[model samples]
Target: MAEELRIRSNGDLASALEDYLAEWSGRSGIAVEIWALPGQAVSRRVAQAVYATVVEALANVERHSHARLVSVAVTTGKAGLRMTVSDDGAGFAVDEAAPNAARGLTAMRAHFAGVGGTLTVNSVPGGGTTVTGVVRAG
Candidate 1:
């Protein structure tokens, strides 16, 4: 399953996410939008990390956030290729010390770190959430 989910390019990643959102759109009130910037090719390994990060973040939004809309973007810039997933929903405080903090987010952080990348999440009660994962090409 993991092998099948490997992303080959930004466009491919966007299509995969669109399919995922299509499957989940009916289950919740949220609508998903994806934007992929035209640029360089992404390595399979880095794409995989970005893919997983988006998948996990979307699942969280579907299950917990009663958000009306979610936006997913993949862009290549001077820093690197970055993926951002944002949702307008009731957010929760990000507590790294909390027991629940070590689950998905921790795993995502580790995944990005392995590829010389970083993951950042911003959320506050009633302020919505945005998760950004970045990876540089070697």
Candidate 2:
């Protein structure tokens, strides 16, 4: 199972995410969907970073967002390899940084930066949250 789950490249990320979400969605009843651009390729480092970002984002929704639905989309084009995780949950202000900041968001940001990528988060109170990470993978 461990070997099967290992992600050696970007090609493995979509299914890995789907598998990861399947476990929680099955038990928690939150609808999670993953869509990836077919044939898009990314470096191992970028793949790992993006995968980590997705994990953190989904975990956040599960733990705090109280979201009923979550969607993760992956694509590659002129803008590069990008992944967006959106959740229809009880959103919070993205500007009002918590005094005791949650490390999840910070870690997700760092993961993208470490791979020469950018992470953008957009959210408003009572609205949903969208987290997007893009890396130059071409």
Candidate 3:
């Protein structure tokens, strides 16, 4: 499950991530909040991977979260890159009861796996969903 992607520079990655959020995340009528660390830092490969996962998670939120408020956040440190996309909609079980239900999370897992990273999805059926990822700095 290796995903091959061109590594983008920090500035380019930052811009790309923001643009992706603007076009894909916010346009869906779900509010988005971005919190990125200031300064030129971290690996672009990891940044892109994290950004892709965030966008995908937000996409799922937009498509199904039924939530008016969806939040996307990014944080980086020597520990690694952390991102969370959460919504206030009624959530579903992470179990595979239906096909494609977890497709986004699956792709997210693969995306991070391709970079020696990890993806975590938490959902409470009547509550909401939260997808988080952590990829080590390269």
Candidate 4:
């Protein structure tokens, strides 16, 4: 990721994410459906946070979800930056999973919080998992 950022001068978040996702999906064998990506440039701090969060979210999906497909979306609006990583996999009980038990979730939340954003995770047994992050506009 660092290499990618450096190559793009650390401003093209969309391109960095695209390359990352393409490589990740190829290796994980999980089909990725990109729903949206910001057309405009985002702040470097916000971009890094979002990128790290997305990486962690996908890592969780690969490690635990057993998902065949994952959908990712990122957009910027009056609410600031919003991102969602949803997977059609074996979802676990959110309440049962302690914060300590799932360090990845904690890390993801921290990524967003570092940028004054909030993270939400929703999942149910046999259903699926959705990780959402929102950073409010200043």
Candidate 5:
């Protein structure tokens, strides 16, 4: 059962995650937005990061945002990989961006930094929140 769920194909990662997230988000009433470029030659860690970060971001949206809409965008280029999760939620404060601000986000940042990447947290009083991370794998 679990073996069947394990991903052996590369391009299927995004769709798998999308399908899984679709059900989960539907249950939780989250409007999920996703964008993927074609011809993406995915590797294991790349897919893993995508899953991890999306899960983490959605969890945050569910717990903190109270956002009616959530947008997730992923783009890969010769420079590096970029993932942005934005939500129109009630934002909070993170005075000093450290490894301990928000437990989940702290972990997310660590995940990015672990692979020579960086995560930036941006929020507005009423506008929205956007979490952007870049992982250098290429």
Candidate 6:
């Protein structure tokens, strides 16, 4: 990921993410369906934040979700940049104070906050998990 980011600095974010997802899917043997990605370029800070959040979200999915499929979406509009990573896996109780889960969530939130964005996570024991982030347009 560091190499990819270095090579893609200030380049096409969508393309870079697509490449990374493809590689990740192949290695993890987990299917990833990218629903959307912004076509235009975004600031380096926003791009890095979004990419890092996605990476963290997928890492959690691989480590805990026990999911067969994951879906990702990112878009830029008047409201700003929005991203969502959803997994069809064995979701856990969101209210439970699990140490590892808390740490991962905190890291994800920090990544977004660094870019002046906000992150939200939603999950149900029997359902799935969704990590949503939004960065309002400046």
RMSD of each: 2.9, 3.0, 3.9, 2.2, 3.1, 2.2
**Model 4 lDDT tens row, 7-107:** 25557888888988999999999999999987777888888888888888999999999999999999888768889999999998787445545678888
lDDT of 5 by residue, 42-110 (tens): 566666665676678788888888899888777777766788889999977756634446578877787
TM-score for each predicted model, relative to the true structure: 0.81, 0.84, 0.79, 0.90, 0.82, 0.90
Question: Which pairs of residues have clashing backbones in candidate 3?
Answer: none
Runs of candidate 3 with Cα error greater than 4 angstroms are 1-11, 37-40, 96-102
Q: Provide backbone clash counts, one per model.
A: 0, 0, 0, 0, 0, 0
Question: What ranking emerges by TM-score with the best candidate at the front?
Answer: 6, 4, 2, 5, 1, 3
Q: What is the C-alpha lDDT of each candidate?
A: 0.74, 0.77, 0.70, 0.86, 0.72, 0.86
Per-residue lDDT of candidate 6, residues 38-106 (tens digit)? 766788778888888888899999999999999999999988999999999999777745534567789
Q: How big is the positional error of residue 41 in model 3, measured in Å on the Cα after superposition?
A: 2.7
Superposition error at 131 for model 4 (Å): 0.3
What TM-score would candidate 3 get against the native? 0.79
lDDT of 2 at 50: 77
Q: Candidate 1's residue-wise lDDT over 3-28, tens digit each?
A: 33545444365556566667767676
Clashes of 6: 0
Report how far off residue 65 is in candidate 2 (Å): 1.0
Of 1 and 4, the candidate ahead on TM-score is 4
lDDT of 4: 0.86
Give candidate 5 misplaced runs (Cα > 4 Å). 1-11, 37-39, 97-100
